[model samples]
Target: DEVFTGDERWRGLPVPAGDRFAWEPESTYIRRAPYFDGMPKTPEPIADIRAGRVLCLLGDSITTDHISPAGSIRKTSPAGQYLVAHAVQPVDFNSYGSRRGNHEVMVRGTFANVRLKNLLAPGTEGPVTVHLPDGEQMTIYDASVKYLREGVPLIVIAGQEYGSGSSRDWAAKGPRLLGVRAVIAQSYERIHRSNLVGMGILPLQFLANDTPASLGLSGKESFDIVGLADVLAEGFPRGKDVEVKATRPDGSGVRFKANVRIDTPQELQYYRHGGILEYVLRQLRDAGR
Candidate 1:
């Protein structure tokens, strides 16, 4: 039998020569190795949630059923029209619940709810009309895609009781996939808010009596969420204020404050690790030893 000497650091760690062992390799070796060879070398972490640079709000009491409906289709709604236009096979255009795994389908299906009247693209009397950069009338999802393609940051502003329905992971995953970086609402429903955090979507709350309308927020404005990393790091300890800088269409800006939804150290760790899924996977792998 042949024997290969393991690294000196693994001398008595019970690791066999051919088996895996934790070795602190030089930076060059790690960076140039086969597993990481194609990885982008950047000063910042690779899985940072803040990298998406967009924010999209979940409206008040947005149920998982709302995020991705679980019923028959009409063939004329946004999801239906998009599917047909894209040449998707009729049989393949299943319910939103079934297609949640695919970003393409979910992004197209977003904001497709029957009651969802896109304030930006309101069909009738409304507070404002959202104009796509192309000067065309389209659904909010289309506009979101345009913004995402333009590399502009997004943040969703919403009213009270946001995300108030069933516990659906896809509800959170969908927004993250859509390039939403944060969600600032007047209030949050317990499970949905945690789900947002689990999917790496920051959830912030307005102070008492503050709301999207109260702050004169419209879907048209751009927003910047400051002190996000710190808020996540500190687990959003009570009294910590999250500042939001909103840039209006005319280029003027106003600042508002929100309360971070993170309430515990475990949650902070989850956020730091880029959500609960990654955190759980890491734990599983570690325990297998």
Candidate 2:
């Protein structure tokens, strides 16, 4: 084996002490993630998603590209605004994929593909959604912020082949950061479904030829996912049935049973810990103790 020489270009950079990392406090490309912020040694029990609002209603064949943080950051997009607020120039603004380490940018970039159409905002495209009850239309990130302010969990309603594309981690991570608690779709791309579970998002699949159109879900309802509390309390089982109730503005409701997509025991553990990252952290912490 040949002895390797260090690159001369970065030879003079100050190195961090011991095993510590030199985290930049103001770097746009790589900021600390909040996934483990205030993470307890033990994870709290996962709860049933109650009174969750539909963040968007999407049609079939929605790809990971439609959901992931990718492409160039627009000067007017939420991610761009964030960068501008942090004093980054428009000319210097990079692509969302290049800034994935910053949850703030990535979350704002979620569902923001210019070509992505949201049924909630018909005749329009990009990251736009109508916030529930008040029915105010705004950017998805803005609406999510308002929903989060009021402690409302968000869900996505979609048709067949949802998340069908390359396995992009930001596709799940962005939604999780945006407060998306669950996704009810006719189907899912296999890896994306697992990635959703890894991010602590519940992926529920429609049962028996059921579709959002058939269910009369107008994306205007407040939803309640029943049986999860009980199931998760005991122990999460693969393919458990959960009841989803969508209450419309008129107080009428559409109810249906959906199959929980946590398909394996290992995935169950990932969800129980609120995510795989948390599970690994807890394991390492416990092992050291």
Candidate 3:
């Protein structure tokens, strides 16, 4: 099956030199992404996600595909429309899997699945939510934009097997880009949970007996996750629990315990400084010194 020998060369062709790659600035595969602009600051080793808006209150069996979809981008969808508007023809609007290098596309494609049923937009499906304090329904990205402008963080409340299936990276990256600070679920597919930690998103598990339904989450409440920072400070131990206090519009509240799922020293470091990439970067930076 070899098309040619290793020594084969076309005449008059310029050779690529050196061990370093010559990165093309206009190439679709950008070696560096604008999505991750600044070096991640020294995160406060704190995991306290307080009073954030609920982007979605979902039910069980939520797969990675739902969190960050694959396959063809629908022509009218956010990612597709963005490509078209930028002069990429509808025919050239390829699968999200192929557009991974572009954070703008992937972030827009984050929850843009056709079958996603976010409880916030009852009886409707796909990547939509209600941005509150104003209660306007919009695309999840747009809602996250408004929330970001308002200096608000975001959270997703969900049922069991929250991130089941293939550990697609964007399933975590997309939400984090949308400013999702935490995800409290009945249980997590182990790999996906780790991926969340890798992306610096706190993944909390409800005690085996408690489900989102049992907590009476309506996708309308504001939440404050307490004790994360204290737990981390006390030495990142296994089986530690944090409390989630959810407040309704009427000022009523519900409090419950969730297992802090960070089971390793490395995972703790990753979570502390916002994610694995930042943790590694910091380590390399320090080591070089």
Q: For every model shown, what is its TM-score relative to the native structure?
A: 0.70, 0.95, 0.90
Winner of 1 and 2 under TM-score: 2
Candidate 1 minimal-lDDT segment of 10 residues: 27-36
Candidate 1 clashes between residue pairs 3 or more apart in a chain or in different chains: 53-153, 54-154, 54-181, 55-154, 55-155, 55-156, 56-156, 57-156, 120-130
Model 3 TM-score, all chains together? 0.90
Relative to the true structure, candidate 1 reaches a TM of 0.70
**Candidate 3, poorest ten consecutive residues by summed lDDT:** 27-36
Give the clashing pairs for model 2. none
What's model 3's overall lDDT? 0.84
Give one digit per residue, the lDDT tens place, for model 2 in 56-121. 899999999999847899999999999999999999987988888888899899999999899999
Model 1: lDDT to the true structure:
0.60
The list of candidate 3 runs beyond 4 A from truth reads 1-31, 34-36, 45-47
| Each candidate's clash count | 9, 0, 0
RMSD of each: 11.2, 1.7, 2.9
Tell me the deviation in Å of residue 156 in model 3.
0.9
